[model samples]
Target: MGLLFSKFSSYLFPNIECRTLMLGLDGAGKTTILYKLKLNETVNTIPTIGFNVETVTFHKLTLTVWDVGGQERIRPLWKYYFPNTTTLVFVVDSSDIERFSDAKEELFSLLGEPELANAQLLVFANKQDMPNAKNPAELTEILDLGSIKNREWFICGTNAHTGQGLYEGLMWVKKQMKA
Candidate 1:
């Protein structure tokens, strides 16, 4: 009887709506991750010029994801998309150690924004399948995630090419939304 009630409740409330913003440096695989989450398969992607919005359903959640371009020139445009964001998914190129500083700078800048004060942050240490990819712990230290005390945050290693860890990241975001 309990199992039946749970199923019935889920059927009645099928989807929790979430607005997610995906941000990162140009080669951090934000577009790739977005397509992987939406299509469940890899797709050839060019650098996003402005942004791409997509709706993806994971279990009982319907996520409206806004993937913004992360080039240096486009960084100024990111704030415009931050107003109603429920979750911020920041992708990082785990294999690119030289650019870690740049990524860190942008991430910190975003965190300082007043508009994102209430947003949950999910940082993806992306490209984990690459031979030189950094792990999640290293990324946490490099990104200074440990010092963050204002809002909910999580970090996960992900390989967008094979979809490993993508769902786990989304699940974390779902849990944050519930909290």
Candidate 2:
């Protein structure tokens, strides 16, 4: 069964290369999620200053992920990396209710960019392990994801500390990319 599935996946998504951008507010755990995907283990990460790029192979897909700094001072530079991005993974601090509006603003701004008009969006409600963490449904409502149209988008409650929901999110992106 394993071999059969492997062959089927390879046949369907042969050497597919996807460029994914990880963007969100600072302290949203974007870097943590990137390291979890790349290393498959927890690792300490400081706030990203500019950006960090890494590639990881998931199933039959090769994803080149660019995790850019989410600080206010660095947002202007995000446009420079928008070109050719196949997926946009926007991480949100599920426990941080104070910055939901900030995240919504940034997300809408990014979606408005012509360069990313065709990109698929995967919103990660990170820090789900926290006691006060919001679920994906609530986050979606708060972010007004329902209003989005004419683009592919998904939201998953993720806990970067234990790597939960990370693979599922990636798999969703992979499937969308295939479509």
Candidate 3:
């Protein structure tokens, strides 16, 4: 599909590409976000088999989001697309404390890559509707991203089921593409 799109777009636009990747722990609502972009509704997001792609066109720039699977077994595949990404959406399940470590490890490994040397990360601290959810400040600390240079982060609370913060998050991604 990527090859077909590449061929099609090259003949059409000739020169256009995306600037982002969305990845995080499983159940972080990344797929939900993808659905919001494509269908305006993510009814059932079966665990992404490997990765998924969605495009958002705004202000003359095409933002292609590579929604990578967050499962431990699938994360190694993320590096394959790192070279083209300029920004990242690191979604987290704020109510799931047991998984924060996994999220942090992935974030650290991603930041270490030269491909993502200057990526801007938007951490969606999701599940804010749940009583046990963690807030943005806690997410910043738990994700352990204090040392990453030249990266900006926004902590948003989202109930993926209700689509709260979904559009705002994409708009933020749109903003970064403009910058």
In model 2, which range of ten residues has the least summed lDDT?
Answer: 8-17
Candidate with best lDDT? 2
Please provide TM-scores, in order, for all candidate models, with all chains considered together. Answer: 0.93, 0.93, 0.81
| Every candidate's lDDT | 0.92, 0.93, 0.78
Cα RMSD (Å) between model 3 and the true structure?
6.6
Question: Which 10 residues in a row give candidate 3 its minimum summed lDDT?
Answer: 10-19
Ranking by lDDT: 2, 1, 3
Task: Compose the digit string of candidate 2's lDDT tens values, residues 23-106.
Answer: 999999999999898998889999999999999888877999999999999999999999999999999999999999999999
**lDDT tens digits, residues 1-179, model 3?**
99999899767754334677998888788888777766767578788878888786544456788898888888888888788677788888899988888778887887778888778777788888888898878777777666666677666777787878766776776666556
Worst 10 residues of 1 by lDDT: 170-179
Off by over 4 Å in 3: 1-17, 58-61
Candidate 2: segments with Cα more than 4 A from true spot: 1-13
lDDT of 3 at 163: 79
